[model samples]
Target: MIGANSVLTLAVNIGIAAISYVMTIRMIPRFREMFIKANLYGKDLCKKDEKVVPESLGVLIGCVFLVAMFFFIPIPFTFGDAASAEVATTGGRSEVFPYKEFVELIAALLSICCMILLGFADDVLDLRWRHKLLLPTIATLPLLMVYYVNYNSTTVIMPKFARMFVGNTLDIGIFYYVYMGMLAVFCTNAINILAGINGLEVGQSIVIAGSILLYNTCEFLLQHQLDAHLFSMYLMLPFLAVSLALWKYNRYPSQVFVGDTYCYFAGMTFAVVGILGHFSKTLILFFIPQILNFLYSIPQLFHFVPCPRHRLPKYDSNTDLLTISTVTFRAEELNFIGKQMVNIFRFLKLISWKDHADGRITTNNFTLINFVLVIFGPVHENIVTYMLLGLQVICSIVAFFIRYPLANLFYDT
Candidate 1:
């Protein structure tokens, strides 16, 4: 017979998969209707319309299914104060499951509501960005509550060389709240931005879930920490469920997109879990791609760089020379330069002077710099660990980028 734990996990997984299949079926027609009503069919706003569904309804149903799964799952067993007491008798210090879980769940629900309501409003009446920001900000209060209730007193800031050099002692009082609030806001926005492409945000969530699982497994091996492992297992369920469910429609030529609602909730859950596991550093490494994307786009968003212009350097077909006027550097410029360098390195021996002699652009090699970064960018405490991280990063980056061209080359009709 299967162990009780394994049985429960299997049951939960099957239940969620069943629910997701049902929800997807129920949602497709509604999605079609919404797309037709919005006049968004066969547009660049979305990739395809045959499978496209209404974002609001799909998100709402998905969230409900997720919440129900959480309640039904036996792992990360939710308990009352009495149950907490019982567990404490077994040497558990905390009588209750960490309050953070409940708080995060509620926060997720509220954020879902905000996104759905705003999306619906935008679809119907077209709400502006100001309202969109305001509504979500207001709805994020529950998240702030979680921050205050669970992490308010927690020490988030550590003393660094700057503090000692400046003769400033660390202030744990107000700083903690400020730090938590900032983290919450930043996570919410980062996830939102990362939601630009189908399956992109969900893929990032998978990376995080996998990392946490690894961390928990390591703790189990090193410290025999059953509780931590159990917690990680519990956390993995929702993420895994959502990822698989979303993937059903979000794979190549995606049918539906998990918009800000899903992305924000996923990000918040990741942040909370990372905080709980005390794996903030690991979390950062896992999410380095999204973080770098965010950092790179910030300047463009603020108009610090040229606006509404996406100019690529003009290449002379005959001379194979770049001839774009350069006044100031932009993010795209840096990216283009990097791409050129990588391409030049890749084809140094093959390309004849005649190729550039004609000033004609013959090849596009955008992934070369990305390849180098993935192969060498990972930093770790030990040489072995560093090598492992570098290899993992390279594999991941290669897999993600190669998917695009490979699909285009082989699958595109």
Candidate 2:
């Protein structure tokens, strides 16, 4: 049940979240000039005038979230202890620490800290693509280790249709653990690769976090694993607070860039909540757009098609509109297999492309930002961002539908 103490703790956390929001908003303006002086600035490629704005300000959210989490730790443990003190005294079971929960909390914090460090390093060093993709795997090890130590449920339910062939569940053993690690990597890179336009990254983050927060609240009220859902809520509230603050300036007609730092930290934060809350599958549903973006990008990612340095939409200075960018392929550069894959993409109309008179081919880059541009045919930046945000919202609704009503048809409750 949702007790008085739980309600009180939530109120206190809301206060803390509000303060985090204020701190982040104030810090952004202050950090702007300092960062520019340090040459940590980027040209707004989407803008007509191309203003040089302070970049990598997303590290601020990481810092503020960390600080809030550190100072706020005592509240949860103390309150839980206070709530159960009478049982401890009367039952004479003796005092016992909530050791498992404590370890989980500490592990989550340490893992997030590692991601923040890695993200900042990427921004400063401009590491290679290989390092960029694989370093997050290293950062996720702490989380996997803690999961293995604390609550290692390696079994998963079989779909109702497949149950007759096997059984109700399958013990996947170590492969389940493998899936968790890959989730972390995918989450980090998914957010990174889907971004380019102003406010798109942070805006999508807020939508996903908010959707998870909503789900947690529902699960808590339904009294199904209240503690786990509460654990999830604590992490998400502060994230939304900080992310909303960052999004304010990062949004269309942007004032600041969120940088790779914010994306990594934000992705890892979602991963932590989903893993610790015991809802990783449900968490993934909210990422439909990201998943689609990745699938569309497979050809370019594997080098079957030529991938540009930046796959973001192109800006038309004269029209002040952004159009979908393209990847170019020359016959000599592509192998047989690559050419086949490219032809498959074109035949399916999965992409829009043209055969140049100069014996070259050009096709739309496989990114969600550009995909949206292709659909709408070059609109205003604000309009494109809003449409993407709307898409995120719609995906959340679809996720809930699949999780609840639709899921009953596929699996046992």
Off by over 4 Å in 2: 81-94
> In model 2, which range of ten residues has the least summed lDDT?
81-90
Tens-place lDDT per residue, model 1, 257-283, is 555556655665565555444544345
Model 1 poorest ten-residue lDDT run? 364-373
Total clashing pairs for each candidate: 17, 0
Best by lDDT: 2
**lDDT tens digits by residue: candidate 2, 130-167:** 98778778888888888889888988899989988889
The lDDT, on a scale of 0 to 1, for candidate 1 is 0.48
RMSD per prediction, one decimal? 12.3, 2.4
Give all TM-scores, in the order shown: 0.57, 0.95
